[model samples]
Target: MSSEIADAKPTDLPKVSSGSAVVIHPRWVRITHWINVIAMFVMITSGWRIYNASPLFAFTFPPAITIGDALDGLPGALLWHFAAMWLLAVNGATYVALGILTGRFRRKLLPIRPMDVIRDLSAALTGKLSHDDLSVYNAVQRLLYAGVIAAGVVAVASGVSIWKPVQFQEVAAVFGGYDAARFVHFFAMATIVGFLLIHITLAILVPKSLRAMILGR
Candidate 1:
C-alpha cells in the first residue's frame, strides 16, 4: 500500500521560482466545504433510514448508521433527510456559483482530456502520480470532483422524484419510474460514499495533501 502511494514531484509544466507555502483555498471554499461535509453526513444517515423503511434491495442498512432507527422509525429520519436536503442544495448552489464567478472550476477541473486521465491513472497505479503544488489538483482529482458533482445532482434529482412522484413525474420517468428513481437515488448515494472513501484513503496515503484542505497551508 505504501509503495502504491504517489509523491508530489514537479510536473513538466513551465515553472518559476517558488517560495514558502501560501493559502490557495479562499474563505468561500472552506466555508462551503465544511457545510457540505456536515450536510452530507446528515443526509446519508437519514437517507439510510428512509431506505430501510422501504428497501429497494434484499438486505437492509444497519440501524447504527440510520437516523430513523435511532429516533424510532421513518419519521425521525424524514425530518433529518428533509433538513439536510436544503443545506446540501443551498451549499451546492453556492459552491457552483462561486466556482463559476471565481474561475476556480475552470482553472482546476476544466479541459481534462482522455489522454490526461489515462496518464494520471497510469501514474497513480505505478506510484508516479505527482502533487507538487498543494493548491492545484491532479488529473484524477479533477475528474473525481467533476464526477462527484454530477452524482450529487443525480442524488438530488432522484431524491426529489422519489419524494414527489406526481409533481416530478417527468424526472421519475426520465430515470425510468418510481422504482427506478429509488435505484438511482441509491446508486448516487453509493457513488458519493465511494468517492468519500477514496478521498479519505488518498489523504491518509498523502499527508501533505490533507493539510492543504484542513489548515489551508
Candidate 2:
C-alpha cells in the first residue's frame, strides 16, 4: 500500500486544504464603504433640515430625523450638510476610480440583461432567489448598484447647481431652472433613500453578506 501510494500521480492523491483565506471584500472597499455610510447618514439628516428652509413639497421631514440647532437653525444645518457633502463626494469619487481602474465595475456591475432582471425580480419577490454566493450578484442587485451610483452623481450635480445658481447656471439650465433643479435634487435624494431601505433589508436578511463586508471573508 505504501509503495502504491508513492507511485500515484498528484491528481490521484487525496485532496488537502491549501488553508488560504478567501476575501469577499478588499480592505479599501470596506474602508470606503463604511466611510460612505457615515457620510450618507449626516447628509440625509442635514439635507432634510435644509429642505425645510424652503420646502418644495407640501410635507416636511420631521425634526426627529434632522440635524438642526434652535439657536443657529438653517445655518447650522447647512454647515453639517456641506461637510458631509465633501466627505461623500471625495469618498464616492475614490470608489468609482478604484472600481474602474481595477475592473471591479465591469466584472460585477455590467451585462445586466433585461430578461435576467425580470427573472431575478420574480424569484426575489417569491422568496426563491438564492443568495448563497456572496461574491456573485444577481441581476437585480447589479441594476440597483449601478442605478444608485448614477443617482449619486445626479444628486451631486443638482446640488451644485442649486448651491451656486449664478456660477453653475449652465448646470442649472440643463435641469431646466433653479426650481427644476430643486425637484431633481429632491427626487435623487428619494431614490437614494429608497435604495438604502432595500439595501438595509437585504443586509439583515442575508447576514452573511454583512459579515463578509465586516470581516472580508
Candidate 3:
C-alpha cells in the first residue's frame, strides 16, 4: 500500500490542506471598486475647490479650509473634475458589465425583499449588525447601493448641464433649469459624502468589513 501510494502520480494524490484558508477578491470587482473610489475622491476634492470659488452654502461661522482651494485654481479644479468624471464613468460602466455577466447585479444587488430591508434597518439602528452576520449586503444595503448608483448617473447628467449649458440645454431643462441641476449635483455629492461617513463608521464598528472588501472574503 505504501509503495503504491509512493508510485502514484501527483494528480492521483489526494489534495491536502495546511489548515489556512485563502480569501481573495474577484479581480474585476476589486479593480472597478478601487478605481471608482479613487475617482470619487478626486471628484469630491476638485468639486469642492470649484464650489469655493462661489461658496454656495454660507454659515455664520466661516467654512473650514479644503483641499480643493488649497491645491489649485479654478482651471486646475475643472481639469481634475472632468478627468475624474471620465474615470468614474469608465469604472461604473465596467462594474455594471461585470455585474451583468456574473448575474451579481441582479442576484446580489437587485431584487431586494421588503422584509430584509426592514430587518437590516432595524439591525443597523440597534447596532446589532456585524460583518459576519452580514457577509453580503442586506436589503437596505442593496437599496443604498442602488441609490448611490442612481445618484452617480444624476451627478453626471447635472454636471453636463452645467459644463455645456448651451449644448445640453434640454438636459438642463429636465432638472428645472441649470441652477436646479447645479443644486442637484451638489446635493448628490453631499449625499455620497454622508454615505461615505456612515460606511466608514460602520466599517469601524464591524472591523471585518474593510478586510472583506480588501481581501474579498
Task: For each candidate, give its TM-score against the true structure.
Answer: 0.85, 0.89, 0.79
Tens-place lDDT per residue, model 1, 64-178, is 8777654457888899999889999999999989887766776668767888888999999999988777667778888999999899999999998999999889989989988
Whose TM-score is greatest here? 2
Candidate 2 clash total? 0
Candidate with better TM-score, 1 vs 2: 2
Any idea how many clashes model 3 has? 0
Worst 10 residues of 2 by lDDT: 8-17
lDDT of the structure predicted as candidate 1? 0.83
Q: Which stretches of candidate 1 lie over 4 Å from their true place?
A: 1-20, 70-72
lDDT of each: 0.83, 0.87, 0.74
Off by over 4 Å in 3: 1-25, 59-65, 68-72, 133-135
Residue 204 of model 2 has an lDDT of 99
121-196: candidate 3 lDDT, tens digit per residue: 9997898755564335677789888778778888888888988888989999998898888889998888888888
Cα lDDT, model 3, residue 170: 97
Candidate that beats the other on lDDT, 2 or 3, i.e. the better one: 2
The order of the candidates by TM-score, greatest first, is 2, 1, 3
Give all candidate RMSDs, comma-separated: 7.0, 8.4, 9.1
